[model samples]
Each structure stands twice: as structure tokens, then as C-alpha cells.
Target: MSCASEQTSKNPMYTISKVTQSQLTDKDIFDEELDKEITDYDIQEAAYYAQKGFRVPLKSSIILAQSGAQVPDAYMQAALSNYYNVSVYNGFSKNKSSSNRRKDKEQQVNNNYMKLLRLIAAKGGQNTIIVYWGTIEKGDLDDKTNIVKWSQYEGGKLSSKTKALRYLLKFTLVDVTTGNWSSYSPVNIEIDYVPPKIGSSITDALQIDELMKKSYDNAALLLSEKYKDKTK
Candidate 1:
């Protein structure tokens, strides 16, 4: 997927929408034409709010399904949707399984998110980007453990009364890029949130983190189950 680095820093980003399918066509994606069109929609919407002068972030959703699907359309219609765009590098692949496409999309999307998290973490952490890199590079790259845990942090406390803490979502940066993985640009960002109290009654913030963690895993599992080696 393409990132608008030059255009993005003009404003900050926050708020994320869930990934969904859209009903775009191959003719729509030729030469990234469709993404550009929608990205323009995102820019205009951002500008509209920029004129009003708000610190709101440019938020967009990733494509979890095919082109021209409802998720993208719904996000496009969101009051905040205008500030964001959808992406799925493999969404238009006519030769791949929908599940595999979704997994690839999840990996790629999370990698991008991790970059943002890394920047945020670096603001107050002892670890530097170089240290983070060395850790990941030392392992069997194919294994998930080889991935870099940018660092761990306390997302928040469980409660004012209970001394117990909630989920500790590890901010992981894994490689999901297309070519030689020298940069963090094309990777998927995974927030492996593991909550503390997983049962009922409590906030279960850890559960929330677990759910986030499962999003990527589920995408991969679904892809493997549905497509096998059929990915194009």
C-alpha cells in the first residue's frame, strides 16, 4: 500500500475505524487510480476540518475485504471518515483467497501502526530504534518471535480500588513489507494486548487487548484454513 508521507505530517492522526469490504473494481485499481481517488476524498475531508481548526487526527480504516465493499463505503461516509482512507494491497487480487488477502492486509496495516507506536514509545523509553532493530534481526526472521517488541507499556490501570492492572499490550513491529526489509515503512503493526482480568464484571481491558491481538491472528488463521497454498 502507498503512504502519503508528505501530505500526512500536515496534520496528526488518531481514531481508527474497523476494516471492512468495499465494492471497487479492477478497472478502479489500475495504477492505484482508485486508491488515489479515495485518498483525495480523505485529503479534502481533512482540509475541511483543518479550515475549522481542530487538533483531530486524520483517521482511516484498512480494507478487510474486497474492493468496492460496504466497510470502505461506510468509513467514507463517517463524519470523521472523510479524514481517512482505506487500504488492502491484496484486496484486488482476483487469484487469491479472501482470507489470505485479509491476513496480508492485517499484517501490512499493523506494521504501519507499529511505526506510529514506536515513535510514541521512543518519546519516553530507554530503548532506541537501533536496539529494537538488532533484537529482531538476531532471530529466525520467519518465526513470530523474531518480530520486534518495540517495547512494553502499561496501557492503563485496572481500577482505582483494585491494585491489579489490566492488559499489557505489547507494541510489536513485524515485517510485512514487499521487498528487502530494511525499513519499517511497509510492515504491519500489531498491538499484542494481553489483559489482566479476563472474566466478567471487571473492565477486562486485557480482554480488549486480547481481542486486538486476535484480529491479526484470526486473519491469518482464516486465510490458512480457507486458501491453503492457493494464495496468488
Candidate 2:
């Protein structure tokens, strides 16, 4: 009689080598460093693509109030063109009363005057438009108590108490395609003016024309700074 015995395979058993704690930690650090490098390379590539060709050449139209109480045509056109770097056109006209009436009716219904302006700009082949208006009112001094004061002028001439006048200039820029718009009003300008004495024929007390031009220039400069990306 023979006893039965278990037999082992002739091939050696597969064994995994022991990994120390230090070895495992080093491998994790190497993997983290590799991931960081890949992430940095992706960011650099994205930035390079964005800076290649983003802005396109555009043309703009400028529309002033119909009352002809805005900035001079020549100055407004030149200032905006230089600051915004776009071809500027005058979209104001005195003979568009019929069209104006129709637009007014539509504005009453839709309450979107900006959309009307965009339509006008689109007709003129303008990608953008600038519309501006201004108002003048009496202003008080810093103390807010007195609106008039005796101030000395050039040559130390003392005149009667002069009143202060505040000028507010409001302007808006609209994108014809998107109908997106921005409005701005630069800080108002206050000037002391000696009103013409009763029965005096002198009418130019505050030089309203010059003040209007100054306000328009300030508005253009502000717009240029705020929308610098639109430049060319």
C-alpha cells in the first residue's frame, strides 16, 4: 500500500517585489510634477490663440440732437475718429422730419430709442454709432447757499456778482449689430458768468458754443479710455 501525497508545480510561483514607503512617495511626486507641466503648456497655447486675430476694422456714425444745439460738426467728427480709430460719418439731417415722426411713434410703442438709432446707423453702413446731447442750468457754489458771487477776473477787474452755470453733456455709444450700448456723462462744468445788464445788447455771456465743444472733447477722451479695445 502507497500513501497519496500533494505535488507542487515545477515552475516557480510569481512574486511581486516589496515597495518601500519612500519609493511610493517619490513616484507620487514625479506624477504631480508631470501633470503641472502639461497644465502650463495648455494655458500658454490657449493664450497664444486668443491674441492672434480678435478685432476687425469698423466704421461709426455720429448723430447729434435735431435742435442743432450740440457740438460743431467738424470737431465732433474729427475727435471721435482720432480717439476711436474708426471711419466717422454725420448721420444728422434737418430734412428727415417724416422719418423722425415715424421713429417717434415706434419709440412710444416699443420704448427702445437705442434700437431706432441702431437702425439709422445700419442704414449708413456703420458698425457703431455715437449720439450726444447737452443741457445747461444754474448752479450753486461749494457752500450750496449762494448761486452768485463777486469774483475778480483778468486784469483784476471787479464786476457785479456773477452767477454760476452748470453744463451737462450726455453721450451714448451703440453697437449696430448687437444693439448693446453704453452711456456716459462726464463731470459737469460750472462757470461764473456776469449776466448782461438790462438793455445791454451783448448776448455772449458764458460762450455756450465754446463750452459745448469742450464738453464734447472731454466725452470723446473718456470714451477712448473706457473702450480702448475698440481702437483699430
Candidate 3:
């Protein structure tokens, strides 16, 4: 019986275990690739509308959704209210579960986004929705150099050797009427100073608030350029 058991173990089912481990390791990369593809598709769809000279009506109200770590609604409203009637929708919250299959996860996100759009339409009679989110990444020495150059261009000063953090603000505009959407990253803010040695939490909060304001302002300008309102 012992010999027979040893022989069976030699041909044990390692393939299933190995395949599962491989998948676990590659899940993140797979999700990132799929996200990039989805973003590209959104941009292409927006471009198609642009080619056809589509313009969002200035009079129609636009609903806003902030995916994570809520940036104050006032920031976006202040940035874009001048161009269009805009309001922030606080009813939607993101689903934050990790998934083994990225495509299914992507589909779930899309469904949630569309559901929010429909909700806004039903509740407020709004036909357009703009969803925004942000990500923070540690920056390298090379990024510091670029920050210094940008500061110099803007007549501001930044230390070339200071550690930096990159803040990426990504946003999308969807016209619910046609289910047409466009996405953009109008500005990437790299800051040399964050989490001050004293009062780190408060200071970090303030810094993020300021950066969010700047990002939204920049995005508003870009959106205005890309989706020009038809002149009456």
C-alpha cells in the first residue's frame, strides 16, 4: 500500500496548482491591460462624435460622479459650472472587490457607471454624466527633474532633489442620450512636498485638496476645447 501511494504521488495533480498560481500572479497585469483597452475604446468613441461635430448642449445639466476618496464637489462645480450646468451626484459608490477575471470586473464597472447615469437621468432629468477618479504614485528622481522644469516654466520654484509624488486625475464624459463617452487626463500634478514633517495628516489633506482643484480646472479647460458648445 505504501509503494502504491508513493507511485500515485509521483504523478500528482500539480498542474492545477501551478496554473492557479500563474493566474494569481498575472491578474494585476491583465486588469491593467484590459483597463487600457477600455480607455482607448472610450477615447475612440468620443473622437467619432467629434468628427461628426457633436456638441453638448450648454443648457442641459451635467451630473458628476467622483469614484473614490471624494474630492469636494465644489471643486468640480466651480471649475465647470461656467461652461455647463453641472451638479455632483453623491448617490453612487464604487464596488471595491478584487476579481480573478478582469474582463468580468470591467464589465461590472461599466454596468455600475451606466446604472448611475440612468439613475441621474431618472432622478434629475440630466442627460450627461462626468465621472472622475484619481490615483497617486511614488515618483522617481527623473520625475523630480521634470517637476523643476515645469515649475520654472510657470515662474514657480521647486527643488530638483526633493522626493516627489505624482497625482493622476482621470475623468470621463458620457452623454446618456446616446451612450457616447469620452475620457481624458488633462493634467498630471507632481508635487515635491507632501505630508509635512509636522501635522502630516492635515497638511497632506490640504495639499490633496489644492491638487484636486488644479486638476479639475485643467480638465475643464480641455473639455471645453474638445466638446465645444454650438454657438447659438
Candidate 4:
């Protein structure tokens, strides 16, 4: 796992994609090749959008998951699947009778999510979206389900009133033995929203002032009518 910076504004990032497996032969070479291909895709995508009069600003750093202790196999596996562009399971069944290692694996994923949440929360934007993607190598592991986890804060939950953000499902993988990083499976994360009950309403002092003015105006008008005959 990677160390998180103090400020998210210092490094705000949204990943495009990653490779799914790290066990592939010539992994380093494969990474290079994928880099080129991904770059081309990004360029072409940008050009296509530009042709359509869309303004897509590319300004985000690469965000890697990190841990202070020895990383668990589950976390590493998820990363590898993401790196190599494969599928990930949306949910992992908790094994109550499993070894301590299994519990640690589950904890690792949660920890990474918390870290990302903190980073995004620290950002200055009123509406900031963060995407957490996971996947397993195609036929490499028994669990072939594509996992694309994303943040669903209470502020963003959808109901009869509001709509949640939009995102694409994606992942990458890593090798446990060789510590090799794989290519990235691309996913998309997009969100546009306004929080409920945002901005300030009328202040108490302002409200009081308004009421006083109305009362004074009514009193003055009443007195003018009452004294009309005397004045004339």
C-alpha cells in the first residue's frame, strides 16, 4: 500500500484503467506496451470529445493503494486484477471460521477505502466523487465476477428524491510472489450533484428587522388616517 498525502488538493486523481494480471510473462514489457496503448486511447478519446465540443480536463495524479504492514494476498490480488484489466467480485463472502489471515484481507480493503474517503473529503470541492475499482484475472482465479466498488456516502444515496452519481465498472491485478504490477482495466467514474439543504436561508436578525419594518409601516398608515380630519 502507498502512503497518503496530508492534503488531497495536493494530489487529486481519478484513474482511467489498469491491467488485470501480474503473472503474465514479460510483465514489464507488457506494462510498457499497455502504457502506449492506453495513451493512444486517451488521446483519441480526448480528440473525439473535442470534435464534439466537449472540454475534458486531464489533471489528476496516480493513486496507488498502500499499507504500512505487509500487504495481504487478497488486496494484492485485487490490485493485480485491476492492473491487468479484468473482472472483480462486487461482494466477498465473509468466512466466520476462516483463519486470521482472511479477516486481515477484508480489513485491508476497508482500510484503503477509508483512506480514499479521507482524501476526497479533504478536497475543497462541494461535490467531489471518488471511485474504488476491483477485479480478478480472467480465468486466473475462481472468482471471475468483475468488482467495481465505489463510494456511496449518505449525502449521495438515491431515493424517491435524488439521483446518485454515475461510474463505470473496472479493475487491475498484481503478482504476490514477484511483486510485479500488471496492466490496468479501464473504468469510468462520473458524478454531478447538488447536496440537499445547501446554502444559507434568511438570518434571524434579518427576519426580525423585516417584521419590525412591516409593523412600523402599518402603524404609521393607521395613525395618518386617524388624524386626517384634524390635519385638514
Candidate 5:
């Protein structure tokens, strides 16, 4: 409830700033950095709440967004801070004939997906959620339909019909090593179903803090509803 700095240093993974809540909430001094800090807290708390009853690997779930040999540290850090499992792999793509570039790209994607599948199997199937970094066709699970693309929540534009304040986490569950994937679901943190405020549009950062606050509240509510029975 507060952002004030505390003297608790023995426990690691502490990112909450030591500044007082008043200092953090002062609008006059508010900056983009503060906005990000608050948003991160919300995300972490929401993710933490969501994982309460469900079985998840805190550090074994791998997020491979692309074919890159190395995933940036920022992504990994975000995953860790948000209580997500973190694992990764790299594979080589063969050169393709110009006529079949599309086919080759598809093949590369499939290969990466398969490699991830094998990794999940080897990891003992810790109920991993593969957070892929690409878009999936609607209701199309057979093709590359898992692991959300960057366009979903990331600066990407949303359709008018889907215009509402939400925090989305795209994931596909692999409960077992079946050498196939289940359907990917975008977890929309629906908060009260309120219309978007005119002051803040999703694309713009005019009211980013307010938007994130609403999102956090909604996510917490949804997670609570999901695990209510388990908690009891």
C-alpha cells in the first residue's frame, strides 16, 4: 500500500523504492520513471496473485520471443520481477531459396517451437506457460497460435471493439510433453468493464499511471475470483 523505503535488506528481490508514498504520488514531480515504477509494482503483484493456486515454475518457464540467439536481459528481468518462470534456447536457421523464403521462415518457427517443446519435456513438465513473442491467428491452434506477438499489449493498436482498459498476458499452457501445443489464451485483466476515459487512450501515455492502476485492480479481482475456491 505504500512505496516508502524500508530497512528490510536481508530479503532479496526487493525493488520497491524507499521513497515515501507521498513523494511517489506527488503529481508535480511525477515523471515517466515514476510511472514505470508504479506500473511494475502493479504487474508483479497481479502476477503473484494469479499464480497462487495454479502450479507454475517460477524460474523454469522459458520465454523465447524470436529466433535470436540471445534474449535481452531486460526481458528476463521483467519476467523474473513479475514472478514468471524464465528459460531460453537458441537454434540455427538454414538458408532458404529466394522462392521459398516464406516457407523457410515458417519452418524456422516450427523448429523453434519444437525445440521448446523438447525443452519443456526435459524440464519435467513443470506446467510451463510458453510466452511466445508473435501473433496467433484467432481460434487457430494448429498453426503458430500460441505465445502472443508484441502487438497485443505492447504499443500495438487494439481494434475499436476491444477498446477497454486491460492488462494482457499472452500464454499457452503445456501441461505435458505431448509434442504438441494447446490453445493459447490471452489473459485479459478485465477491470470493472468501464469505458476508456477520454483523458487516456491506450496508445497514448497521457494517463498511463491511471490506466495501469485500473488494470492492476482488475487483474487482482480476476485472479481472486479464479483461485477463490482454492484459497478456501
Candidate 6:
């Protein structure tokens, strides 16, 4: 109703300052310097979060994302903050999307899946001689096409038509001891892969494959060396 309000209503430039204000304060500052602040928070929180939870502010997410690697402190810090949950730092009106929460979901499924695999391995090891599992296939476990069941049995509770436990970790164990190693004749080890629907987008699939290939190829070298003496 006032002159400035009327002018703002008619002119886009008048309202542009509001957008600038939104970015600079009370929101995740995307500016390079603000990103640095976020990274510092992330690293400090990550080192402590196992002992402290929500106390880690939204800014600390940088550490959460990058703590998986071992690298120089500066690069680790930068990577930790490089990508973030874009949804948490901004207000609801400004959020328009929620990537942060989605990332947590994906991580939850993957972590639980890995746990389940370890459980299976433990069971196999305990019951008797280690039971060799063949390959894992992604999606639709036997008669259960319902992904919710898959996710739940896999230790999750999210049910969406568009997501899945899309990553699989697979490897075969080999015995490399000599004559005693003959007792350790090499054997291929494997885990079934059921790539989750949400996590297995083409890009993710490629990354998973790359990891698996590298591991399997390295594993093969050990097996090959073990069998070489026998063949000769």
C-alpha cells in the first residue's frame, strides 16, 4: 500500500534485494566463504557425532558426507563440505525441495544392507564350514515383488514405488596358503546383488560396477598366484 510496496509490486528489481537477503543470512550461504564455515562445522561435528547426535548443526553435514575417506586435512575438509543436503539450510518457503532428507534415506538402506550381508556371512561361518553364496541379483527377491518388504527385510521401512536398495557389495574369498595353502585352495567368493530401485540409477550402477570390478580383479590376482604353482 505504501510507495515502496507499490513500487516493489510493479518492479522486479525492487524485489530482487529480498532474494539477495535470503541467500546472505538465515540460509545456507552458498558463497565460497560461507561454504568454508560449513566445512569447518562439518569436520568438528563428524569427529564427535558418534558421541553427539543432533547437536551437530545442519552446517556440520559437510563432515558427515566426507568422513568416509582418508585424505589431507584441507582436501578432506573441502570434500566434506563440497556437496550438501541443499534442503536443510534454507527455510521451507525457500526450500522448494528436500535433498538432504533423501540422502539420509539412501544411506540408511545401504548401511542396513551391508549389515545384513555381514549377518549372512556370520551365519554361514558359524553353522559349519563357510557356505559359499553365489551371486546376488538386484530387485524383486523371489516371489516378493513388493519393494517395501524387500526394504524392510533389508532393515528399512521406506515404501515408495520409485526407490530401492540399489547398491550391492560383492566379493569372493580365496585361500592363499602354500601346501597348507593347498588346504587353502582358492575359491571365488560372491554376494547376491539386488540394486535398490532408488539408488540404482544408471550413474550409481556404473559406480557400483566400477567398485566391484576393481575388487574382483584384485581378488583374481591373488587366486591366480595361488593356483599358478599347482598348475605347473
Candidate closest to the true structure, highest TM-score: 3
Clashes of each: 17, 0, 0, 43, 4, 18
Better of 2 and 4 by TM-score: 2
Name the runs in model 5 displaced over 4 angstroms. 1-61, 64-84, 88-112, 120-129, 132-169, 184-187, 190-203, 206-232
- Candidate 2 Cα deviation (angstroms), residue 194: 3.6
What is the Cα-based lDDT of residue 36 in candidate 2?
36
Q: What is the C-alpha local distance difference test score of each model? A: 0.26, 0.43, 0.51, 0.27, 0.33, 0.26
Error of 3 at 63 (Å): 0.4
lDDT of 3 by residue, 1-232 (tens): 0110111111112211222221111121112334444678777876777677646666567776555322324566677777777656542343434345665654333334355455656577777777665554443345544543211111122233435545566666666666555677875766555435654463544554565567667778777777777576
Alpha carbon RMSD to native, model 5: 19.6
Best-matching candidate per lDDT: 3
Ranked by TM-score, the better of candidates 3 and 4 is 3
Q: Looking at candidate 6, what is the lDDT of residue 195? A: 38
C-alpha lDDT (0 to 100) for residue 158 of candidate 4 = 31
Q: Over the stretch 1-232, how does candidate 1's per-residue lDDT look in tens digits?
A: 3222212111101111111222233222222323234668766765665454211123323222223222222221221123323232222223221233554574222222233323433443312111011001111123445443233222334232222212111111111221101112113323322334545553444343333334334333332233222322
Badly placed stretches (over 4 Å) of model 3 are 1-54, 69-72, 91-113, 140-162, 194-202, 230-232
Candidate order, lDDT descending: 3, 2, 5, 4, 1, 6
Q: Which segments of model 2 are wrong by more than 4 Å?
A: 1-75, 84-113, 140-162, 195-206, 230-232
Candidates 1 and 3 compared: the better one by lDDT is 3
lDDT for position 171 in model 3: 68
Measured with C-alpha atoms, the lDDT of residue 77 in candidate 3 is: 65
Q: Write the per-residue lDDT of candidate 4 for residues 83-122, one digit (tens) a residue.
A: 2222212111122222335645643222223223234433
List the candidates ranked by TM-score, beginning with the highest: 3, 2, 5, 1, 4, 6
Better of 2 and 3 by lDDT: 3
Candidate 4, residue 193: lDDT: 32
TM-score pick, better of 2 and 5:
2
lDDT tens digits, residue span 1-232, model 2: 0011212121111000111111111121111233234678766765665455232233333443211222223444555655543443222322211323564574222323345556665776656655554454543243566545433121221234445545566665555665445666778666555556668764333244355456557766776676555544
